[model samples]
Target: MLAGAARPRMPASAARSRLVEPLSGETRLMLRAAQLYYRLNLTQDQVGERLGVSRFKVGRLLDRALRESAVRIEIVHPAARLVELEDELTDRFGLGGAVVVDVASTGSEQDDELLARERVAGAAAVHLASLQPTGAIGVSWGRTMLEVAAHLRPGWTAATEIVQLNGATSQSARPTRAHEIVERFGATSGAAIRLMAAPAIVGTPGLRDALEQDPSVGETLAAARAAQTAVFSMGVLGPESVHVASGYLGATDLAALGEAGAVGDILGRFVTRAGGIALPSLDRRTIGLPLEELRAKTLTVGVVAGAGRGPIALAALRVGCVRVLVTDEATASWVLDHA
Candidate 1:
């Protein structure tokens, strides 16, 4: 060795590039120490003593191994496809606005939690906040709709009146109460809430006729009919569905709906898979804007999700019930595939 020459300190064992490489007993023991120290939250000294290495050597090996392993991390933002999907749906449907969320299935609990967090309520709240404030806004009721109402931003406009598009009632205690929904929207928008205080389903046609004659209900219905924009969701059939859960439909009611060949319902009007509104029963008792009136609105925004609802949503689209649609990517792709 040359005089005054410094010697580099070499590792006791050769560094293994791949984790699968044959490691010496000491190297293997060092790796185990590093894992125990870092992963298991033990101190370097504790890991070193446990693995029979000096604390200094244990620390050096841990640092070198981690550096060589080089775990690549990345955070992907929401894709431009989201905005493109919005634009495409808007152009195709002549919608005022559209919001499409990315709820792609990742086959994980975290993904499901993330999907649930993408509620239509937040999107609707944002949409309502940006409204131009011109005409009355009609609203329909459902769990998704109620979620929208809850997220609505407060103090929008006092002049902007909210009209309920359907009667508020059900067999159970908590029916599709339009008053609660309307009031929530009113509170958010600072607008007058007009509620149709009638049963969702009356006992008889005679009773329905008598209820419609009430001036208060008639006035509210008129307001709903004249509204330029309406927001609603397509309801699926079944016991645990939103309608059933909201107490708007009992088992017998659902059976009757099924017998009527209803694939889904919109504003309590049963419709087929082809989007033809069936069930004269809906026409007789419901105190709200008719299908024709709903169709006439300049903007009829339908917010719905789930693979099961894709058919109903497509049917609604085919029938021109929805001029604007807000949904997740899974449902959109399903609609296109099925279409």
Candidate 2:
């Protein structure tokens, strides 16, 4: 008989009651500790007395039960986030705040990618709405930003203004949806919308300056500069990048950027692995908020998701451009592990 399963004289029927193998002494102790500590809500000292062991041993047994899968704990919430990951991100990156969306894989890479973006966008929308800003909010245009705008509810915030942070005019046949994103944000928040009516990039630096001097564009840029909060998304350098698709960049331009060690882009400005600008001349022609200005904002919210975006996200955090971050669990973990 096992140490705890003492045997005594019993009826034949009682002896035959053993229908399954007995648990090992250690396994039995672990289960008992888990039951007493968790189910019974007993203190370690009390459990130790019942189990004839020290309180230290009881704690170890409880830990073992959790580690060996003898016990499981789940947070029963539909939109529960990983608070541990959020804490780790905020602490590790020196961020003001961090939100890690717990996204489950959908068994397909493409679908999973889309789901991750939607989850992050939803979280971003919630975070933004909670701020309840009554002033201008600088914003950028992208699919992720559009998703964020869609997630926002009407009357989410009142007396707010939306200022476009970057030029949205795309040279490609594909629309950038720049106007739509800010319009939706303004409509949802019941705020005034100021759109940047200019190309993201021009043929020359001189042309870019001329456009910036235009009254409407100049007013919008001034509004962006005065805004205390900025919300934006990032893009990884690839053929599928919106910059490439928008015709602001072509194959050779991307190749040159890659050669300069760019990992990704923020606010139409590309940066290297260490977050330094990859190409200054290209930045000179791009019309938007200067990258350095992002760090000066009272709040800068960065929303990014999907695989292969860790490098860029990490770069953004390191550069101090992202005071508040909203991303998927995988991306948050990758940033912490690599940071």
| Top candidate, metric lDDT | 2
Q: Any residue pairs clashing in model 2, and if so which? A: none
> Who wins the TM-score comparison?
2
Error of 2 at 147 (Å): 0.6
lDDT of 1 by residue, 1-339 (tens): 478767578774555545556667766765686678767988988888887778898888787667766322233567677777787767765666677777757688565534533565567666656664557888888776776777776775444789888776665755665577889888876777888877665656787778777887788888988888788877777786656776656688788878877777677666877777666875576556677778888878787765577777777777787877877776666675675
What are the per-residue Cα lDDT tens digits for candidate 2 across 1-339? 347665657778765658654767988988888899999999999999999999999999988888988898988775555788888889888888999998899899999999999999999999888877668899999889999999999988764799999998875798899999999999987899999999787768888888888887999999999999999999999899998889888888889899999999999889998989998888888898998898899999999999989999999997889989999988988888888
Error of 1 at 76 (Å): 8.8
Q: After superposing candidate 1, which stretches have Cα over 4 Å from the reference?
A: 1-77, 94-96, 104-118, 157-159, 246-248
TM-score of each: 0.69, 0.80
User: Which residue pairs in model 1 clash with each other?
Assistant: none
Count clashing residue pairs per candidate. Answer: 0, 0
Give lDDT: candidate 1, residue 109. Answer: 59
Error of 2 at 160 (Å): 2.4
